[model samples]
Target: MNNAAQYDTVIVGGGPAGLTAALALTRYRHRTLVAESPAAPRNAASRGVHGMIGLEGATPAEVRARAWAELDAYGLTERRDTTADDIAPAPEGGFRTMLGDGTQVWSRTVLLATGVIDIHPDVEGFAACWGRTVIHCPFCIGWENADRTWGLVADDADYAAMAATGFRAWSADVIAIAPPGMDRAEETQRALRAAGSDLVQGEITRLHHHDGDLYAVEMADGTLIDRQTLLWAPPQRQVPLVTRLTDTLGLALDDDGFVTVGADQQTSIPGLYAAGDLTTAWEQGAMNAAGAGARAADAVHFAHPA
Candidate 1:
């Protein structure tokens, strides 16, 4: 059995959120370790990261590499490229984290940046088109695709209705794709139709694409909707690491199963904090996640000052 090491803070997940927190903790002089699993980032398929000022057109890999480069100069953060298996409250008023390789580490505080996984529908070519023509964030890809044929997929009526209206700003021709069992009220649907958009109420069987550039969305009943890009938010659930911890720790969760944190990003359980996608469902992206990490760092630092 490997002996447990000690640190002031231990951050799980090495995506943008975890990286940002590590950098903030280092600046605050907190000894920290970033424990990352082998799982690729949620945005790994993305060709470019947007909505982050000054980093326009930067690929996700480039953004991560650059963050690491800046952190390396400080030399105050230790990184472990492995999964954090479990976390238990130490008898001595700290945290004991078990790593995937049977190594245990102790820390005064633990931050969970463990992100969620998006569950796309079982449609052909959907996975392949992700991060490209299968648009996740309109703000991230809207400008380049301005005035192109666009599609909106949503399960909720209000969500689809609101999104359909908002999408008109990007393209006059919009198709709202509602999955099975989804329907908007007549007034809402009427309003959408009144705004120069069409609603397709059915499951999509396939997305036709060539080299990740979407060309058409195929409905289940042999209907083809020509579209250049589609905007959708697939369902999401917490990663296994997060699920286990939330269950064992009795952390409070929102309606959508996201960890409910205070403004400071501290979870209901003291000494345990969560940031990024694990903390919220709305406004998801690299930029929002990085900001959450900084907020959690501030709370952790304030809790235990140098």
Candidate 2:
């Protein structure tokens, strides 16, 4: 609770987006502070992040470590085990943020890189296999699980169609498992059939696992479908921290509950910016985060020219 420490910009959440933002601002000689909550929530369920240059196959932890190391080299300040509880507009055209430990930081600007969380299915044993055999996003994990027996566990027909496109490049044995009476579009059905995927209609009651490995899926009728990998889409919800802060600061959110930002990553609220998954619907990793962070930092610099 050191109120004496102030910064030109305070970034909440030290994931890829926040870390990148901190690095960019510090490189520009802007005094920046990053408050990161400890590791607790589950992020992308993959061993390594994909589509990122240079560190393409690095794990999330590895990417974060490398980025933090670089930030440290640049003399950026970081405070771990801290959380931002509230943010209000400062009278001097900035922001006043209160931390969970009762520390207050007054910054000329604030960056909300707080990411989102995925809501997994309630099926038994599903949580245990997540990030290993049970995963989401084919772009990130499909290459690793390529040519293996993959199952698409989805509740909606539209999701099944989208999954079809993403999984097509990985394996030809992709199966769309949905509940009975869920009719799929002709285009999707044709694509599934053309891709040699079976349309499995059943009510999945549970997931069977062994030693952290997914073994099979059990349907309500007692039928077991054995598979090496299970891919499914999770209903995503914005992590509460970002939404609450956006509400407190009167920032605008899009229809899907993501923070609405302009091209420069500046939100409707002046001096408050957002980036990464909190601002975009596309799948993003370290590269996207870095790009967005640079954009937001540039905008902040333009707005607050010294």
Candidate 3:
């Protein structure tokens, strides 16, 4: 058998959460290996990392590169641009991970910074407008585009109504475009109208954009509505690694498909941890992911006191 290389921790991602956790461990002088996936990051479509102070408006790639650049200075953390193919509990109370290149590494603990996958609508122009004009969270990208015409394209009537009504703080012109056959509660409909939001029912055909900026939404009936941005919070699925872990290790997942974690980011399995959008459905931004990573790192560091 090949000798298993060991480290204090192995982070299964290299995005905001994984990089943040690696930084914390390096600060504490812990030996770590960050196995970043070869796949494109979840936020690659995002224009920039929003609502994160000190690093506001930075591109996702820029944020990750900046963090990874700091690793050389510490010399305590190692990085590999490879995916973690398999992870299994070690016989001696640690973990054995297989990299994409078939290298095996053992670690005392594993941090699953693997993020979630955002699902987008199946329509033309949505891809081009995504991250630039089509956004998911208002709080994350609303402030910059305030006062502009906004469209909430949601399948759930309750969420559509709530978002349309709630977005009034950002703009006076808010519209809830519900999918065909979706019905809203009377109370929600009243609230939307009271908030001065126009509610429309139709199948979104396409989002028209000019010069990469969103301009309007075209419906199946060929009706065009002028709008600058679309608030589309699509359902997200766990990354392959997270799903595999849940199946193989029996990690508990909440109804929303997020891995359940405690106050310190530890997963249902002891010594195994998770953070970022993979852990929650709300407050999922770069800043929150970084904070969660730091917290998870602290728990891992303190648990293995030197």
Candidate 4:
């Protein structure tokens, strides 16, 4: 392998976590290679990032652009716009990663910031309106769509109840749709009714949209709910690369399939770490992921210091 192809750290996924880690690793003068797939990011369709100071309302593409530029200025980190096909601990030391383009790179440590994939409901127009009009994070999109028709789709009655009531702060016209066969708790029902939120009991048959803009939702009972924005709380899973890594490298995972890591962000396997959404179930945001990435970079830096 060429010297240029050998890095002290190989970070997978070019989202905020991996990119931020790259910035920190290279700032410490470590040779870092960030392998980012060309696929669309989780928040690609969102108008802007929210809650983060100084970067409020910045688009995902803008964040990545700035990050890659900064990393380039350091001249220690390189980016490969390709997916990591496979990874295995090398016999000599460290790990070897095969890129989707058939190139192999060796690194002293590996960080998986590959993130997660939201398992959206297979409802018509739901996938098309994701990130655009249908979003999961209330903090991310609530302020902008405030006072508009809001719908919360969830299986848990407590969650639906809380979301329906809490969303009243954003819009008085909040609706909670509990899945079929699940009874709403008495307290939950009381909360929704008190908040003046409508409770619908049925499966979402389809989301109605036109010209890529969402307009309404159709329930199984043929009831059409006029909703411009939807607060979709769907289950999410680790990306395929993380799954493969956990299997091939004997890495430990939580019951929810997220990679288990310590406070240092180190995974079960030595010289391997995980950060961002793939490591936590709560607080899945770009800013949070970036902070985790920086912390993971610290762990990697201390582990393999010059």
lDDT of each: 0.85, 0.77, 0.85, 0.84
RMSD of 3: 1.7
Candidate 1 accuracy as lDDT: 0.85
| Cα lDDT tens digits for candidate 2, 99-208 | 87878888888898877787877889888888778876667677877887889877667777654566668876767787777766455667777766666788888888
Model 3 clash tally?
0
Best candidate according to TM-score: 1
By TM-score, rank the candidates, best first.
1, 3, 4, 2
TM-score of model 4 vs. true structure: 0.93
Per-candidate RMSD, Å: 1.7, 2.7, 1.7, 1.9
- Pairing residues by index, what is the TM-score of model 2? 0.89
Model 3 pairs in collision = none
lDDT of 2 at 186: 53
lDDT of 3 at 29: 86
Predicted candidate 3 versus true structure: per-residue lDDT over 227-267, tens digit per residue: 99998877889878788888898999998789999998999
Q: Give the TM-score of candidate 1.
A: 0.95
Which digits, one per residue and each the tens of the lDDT, describe model 1 over residues 1-306?
Answer: 135799999999888799999999999999999997776888889778877888888888898789888888898888888989899999888899999988899999999998898998788998989887887778877876788898888777777776456876688778677866665445556777887766777778999999888999888888998998998878899888778877898888899999999998998889899999888877677889999999999999999864
Of 2 and 3, the candidate ranking higher by TM-score: 3
**Runs off by more than 4 Å, candidate 1:** none
Candidate 4 lDDT over residue span 1-306, tens digit each: 444278899999998899988888888889998999998888787889888788888998998898888888879888888999988888778999989988999999999999999887778888888886787887778788787788887678877876555776788787777876676555566778787776777788898988557798898889998988888868988788788877777789989788899999999999998889999877788888999999999989998983
- Order of candidate numbers by lDDT, starting with the best: 3, 1, 4, 2
Candidates 1 and 4 compared: the better one by lDDT is 1
TM-score of each: 0.95, 0.89, 0.94, 0.93
Clashes of each: 0, 0, 0, 0
